[model samples]
Each structure stands twice: as C-alpha cells, then as structure tokens.
Target: MKLLVCIKQVPDLESRFKANAEGVWYNEADLAFRMNEYDEYAVEQSVQLREKLGEGTELTVLSIGPDRVVEAIKKALAMGCDTAVHVQDAAASGKDPWQIASIIAAYAKDKSFDIIFTGMQSQDRGSAQVGVTVAELLGFACTTTIVGFEYDNGTITAKRELEGGIKGIVRMKSPALVTCQLGLNIPRYPTLPNIMKAKKKEIIAIPVADLLREESLAATTSFHPPAKKGGGIVLEGDMADLVDKVIAILKDKTAVLR
Candidate 1:
C-alpha cells in the first residue's frame, strides 16, 4: 500500500506579525518555523499506517512552498515517510486556499496511492479548505477531523467530529482522503538515528510552473495588523463605589441597560 500525506511549513503561531512597506506580510525574521501542528499529526498517522501495513508500504510526503520548506519535508521523512516531494516556487508564499488545493490535487492526480492524508488545516491560513477542495478535485471520498480510522478487508472506517455534540462514523473503500485532527494521535519526535537516516533519503524538488501553470488567484486587498490596544483602567474604591462604577461603565458600553 502507498500513502501520500501533505505537509506544510508555517510561521510560529505566537510570533508577532507585521506587514512590510510594500503591503506584504512579514514575521519576525529571526523567529523559527515549524511543521504545521496539525500536519505533524497527519504525518504521525501516516507513519503508523505504514508500520501496520508492513515494510512494503510506502509513505510519501508532499509540500508546495519556497525552498525554506525543505526543512518541513525533511522533518516528515525523519518521522518515517519514505520519500518527499517539494515544489519550489516563490509564488506559493501568496497562495490562497483554492490555488494551493489545485496545485496539490494536480500533482497528486498522477501519483498512484491507495490513500491521501492531510492535516485539518494549515496554521497560517486556518482556512480548512485544502483537504476538502483537493478531495473534490481528485474525485475521492473524504472525511475530515478524523479522530479514529481503521482499515480491514478492503474497507476503511473513520470517526469524524461534528458540531453541536455530534459524532459521525463513516465507512469507505480504498482511494480516499482523510484530514487528521490533533486528537488523532500525538506526533512522534524524530530520533537521532531517524534524523541521520532521513538525511540520506532522496527529496525531489519540482518547479511550481510544471505542477500548475498559473496562480488562478489574487489578493484583492493587502492585509494589515490591528492597531495596538490602549491601556486598561482598574477599579479602586469601596465596595459600593466599585459596584456603582462597574454598573455605569457597563451601561455606557452596552445597550442592554438602556
């Protein structure tokens, strides 16, 4: 069995971000980047699947991004993926959800795989569109936020999370897409031996133009950071005075008291 898992490199979530003078996004230049938190879970799931399917099974990690993203691909390999494909294109930095999905789907269409897995969403965009959109483009059955999955006798069963305190159990055949959530499993750290072995593994880099001809996307308006917040005021008075002040402030701020 062969599995393909899409991985992404994202800015650290806690970093302070800003826009440059050219109206482009920028982060703290010295801050570190890591694999998308959810993608790490996806990679771990794929590695587990490979282990279950035996040494014959192959797991491939794919990513679309600039050269710096190789670190993320290597990380996946160290986590147990057999190989990786990285698309180097500066344009990927501005990729919208649709464009990203299209590129991944287009490239993956040619690959022969029984299953494709992805993280529930990328941390940077948090759009949660890529997995579903890629599945649609590839004409595959998809299950998202999958907490549990099992394969037996050519059938795959999955447990999905739903809103409003509902859970869904779905069954499907081979050739499916599953977007893994964090709760699916704790991602394994790359051991020193695994990291050493991963360095010798082959990483294939594909030119972005060869995958998809054009962007097919545009950013209508530039993004900007919100203005810094003003200082806060604390109440300091007797109990009754504090109560009166709180009530007055609430009345001033809200229409409910009116």
Candidate 2:
C-alpha cells in the first residue's frame, strides 16, 4: 500500500508567544518549531498500518512550508516513514487555507495514493478543513475525527466521533482520506538510534511555485491580540436571589432576553 501522511510545522504550544512591533503575528526568531501535535497521531496511525502490512508498504510524509520545515518531516522519518516531500516557498507564510489546500491537492492528485491521512486540525490556525478539502479535490471518500480503523479485503472500516456521544461507523474502499483526532493513539518518541537512521533517509524538496498553476490568493489584513479579561467574581446567596442577580447581569452584559 502507498500511504501519504500530511504534516505541518507549527510553533510549539508550550513556548512563550509574543507578537512583533507591527502587531500582526508572533515573533518567529525565538520560536521553537515542531510537528503539529494532532499530525503526530496521524503519523502514528500510518506507522501502525505499516506494521500491520509488513515491509512491502511504503509511507510518504508530505508538508508545505519554508525550507526550515524539513525538520518536521525528518521527525516523521525518525518515527519510520519511508520518505518525505517538502513543498517550499514564501507563499506558505500566508494564512489562506484555500491556497494551502490547492497546492497540496495539485501535487497529491497525480500520486494515486491508496490512502491519505492528516491531523484533524492544524495547531497554528486550528482549521480542520484541509483534509476534507483535499479529499474533495481528489474525489476520495473522506472521514474526519476518526477514532478507530480496520481494513479487510480491500475495504476500510472507520469509526468517527459525532455529537451527543455517538460514534459513526463507515466502510469505504481504498484511496480514501482519514483525518485523525487526539484519541486515536499515543505517538511514539523517536529513540536516538531511530533519529540516527532518520538522518540518512531521503528528504525530497519540491518547489511550491512549480506545483501551482496560478497565484490565486492573498492575505490583506493582519491581527492584534485581544485585551485581557478581568477576573470573575463569585456570589453567595439564596437560589432565588442568585437567579435574579444572574438574570440582571446577563441582561446588562448581553442581549439574550426577549
């Protein structure tokens, strides 16, 4: 089976973040970059599938970003991916999701992969649309927030989480898209030995511009952080009094009542 896993380099969530003087975005110079945490689950799933299928299967990790993103791909290699492709260009710096989806879709279209997997959401933007968008672009059966998976006789059985504590079970053929959530599995940390092996793995660089047919998008606005919120005050009183006070506060602070 030829499996393609999509990964992204994102600012480490635990690191201290600060916007630059222009109040547009975070300072990149001192930021520690790592693979998006949810993507790690996707990679772990790929590794598990490879183990199930034995040595004949091939796994490819793909990501779009600047040249520095090779490290994120290498981390996947350390976890036992066979190879990686990095789509590099300055356009990756923009926050436009469609631009990213288009570039990934264009490259992935011709690959004819048996399966494609990605994280449920990107850490930086927290937008969970890429997997479905790419799947739509590729005309593949797609499932997001997948919690469990099983394969048999050229068909895939998947379990997806849904509202109201329900789980949806689906069956599809190969050449499908699955976006993983956090509970899928625990990602393994690469040992030093594996890291050494990963250093020798192939990391292919592809220019994003070459893959694109047009520069169809642009980001014209930026952002500044919201003001800090004040501490909450607790009130102790009888139930009727508390309800009246809560109603008054809600009426004053919001337009919820008729």
Candidate 3:
C-alpha cells in the first residue's frame, strides 16, 4: 500500500504573534511554527494503517511552504513516515486553498498513490477546502471530517463526523482522498531515537513553481483581529422576571409573536 499524507506548518498560537509591516502576513521571524494540529491526525492515521498493513507499505509525507516547513515534515518522519517531499516556494505565503490543492494534484497525479490524506482544514485559514479540491483535481473519491476508517477487501470505509452527533459513512476503492478530523486517532510523540533517525531521512525538495502551471495565487485584502465582545449580562431574579428579561432581550430576534 502506498499512502501520501499532506502536512502543514502553522503558527503556534500559544506564542505571541504580530503582523508583518505590510499587514498581509505574519512576522515569521518572531513566530514559532509547528505542524497543523489537524494534520497530525492525518499523519497518525497513515502511520497506524502502515502498522496494520505490514511490510512493503510506503508512506510519504508532503508539505508546501518555505524552508521552515521542513521541520513539520521531519516531525512526521519521526512518527514513522518513510520519507518526505517538500515543495519549496519563497512566494507561497498566502495562496488560497484551490491553488494549493492544484499544486499538490499536479505533482501527485503521476505518483499513483493508493490513498491521500490531509487535515480537514489548515489552522491559519481553516477554509476546509483543500482536501476535497485535491480529490477533485486528482479524480479520486473524497470524504471530509473523517473520524473512523477501516480497510478490507480492497475497499476503505470511512466514518465522517457530522454536526448534531451523527456520522456519515462512506466506502470507496483505492486511489482516494480523505480529510481527517480530530477524533480519527491519537498522534504519537516522536521518541528520542526516532527523532535522531528522522534527521537522516530523505526530504526531497521540489520547487513549487516547477509544479505550478500558472500563478493562480490569492491576494489578501486586509487583516484585522476579531472584534472584542462585551461582558455578558447576568439575570438574577425570579423565574417570571427572568422570563420577562429573556423575552425582552430576544424581542429584536423574534420573527413572529410567541
């Protein structure tokens, strides 16, 4: 079995961040970058499948970004990925999901992978569009927000987590794409030995411009932090008074008398 897992490098939001002078991007010089949390689940699922499938299974971790992004790939290597491919582009700062998926599909189209996996969405943009778009580009069966998976009889079954506590089940043959959700699996931490081994693993670098057919990048218009919310108003009164307060508070939202 051959699997390709897509990973991403995103800002570690626990650390402080500031916008660049142009206000179009973050100041990477002061930021600590880490693997996108959602991608970790994708990587873990790949690793788990390898363990189950046994010998002759190859797993390749792929990411597109600047040099710093290689660290995220190395982390995947330490977690048991066979090797990695890094699509390097100094100008790929803010490409939209479609352009990013197109780049991946362009290179991956020739790879003949049995399955491709990626996080449900990136942490920075959270557009949640790339995985499905890549599948569309590659002409593969695709599913998103997958929390469960099983492989049998040359078919893969996926359980998708949906809103309102429901699961959407899907079954597709090989040469498919899946966007993994958080509950898919627990990502393993890299042991010291594996970390050392990862340093020697191959990380092939391909220029993103080489894989890209055209410059279909997105331009950011503005950057502004979310508006601060005001403190909540607490109601401290009898049930009747509280009901009256609630009715008054919701009056503007009411479309009809009740």
- Top TM-score prediction, candidate number: 3
| TM-score of every candidate | 0.85, 0.84, 0.86
True-structure RMSD for candidate 2? 6.7
Q: What's the lDDT for residue 226 in model 3?
A: 69
Task: Give the per-residue lDDT digits (tens) of candidate 1, residues 1-258.
Answer: 889999889889888777655565664376688999999989999899898888778899999888889999999999999999998877676767888888888888888788899999988778899999989999988989998888875578999988875779999987899999878888999999999999999999889888774455657367577766868677896999999998998899989885
lDDT (Cα, tens digit) per residue for candidate 3, span 114-219:
9999999988878899999999999999989999988885699999999998999999998899999997988999999999999999999999988888555567
Kindly provide the TM-score of model 2 when superposed on the true structure, using C-alpha atoms: 0.84
TM-score quality measure for candidate 1 = 0.85
Q: Which pairs of residues collide in candidate 2?
A: none
Q: What are the clash counts of all predictions, listed in order?
A: 0, 0, 0
Candidate 1 lDDT at 33 equals 87
lDDT of 1 at 30: 69
lDDT-best of 2 and 3? 3
Q: State model 1's lDDT.
A: 0.87
Say which prediction, candidate 1 or candidate 2, comes out ahead on TM-score.
1
Model 2 regions lying over 4 Å from their true place: 20-23, 214-220, 231-258
How far is 245's C-alpha from truth in model 2 (Å)? 25
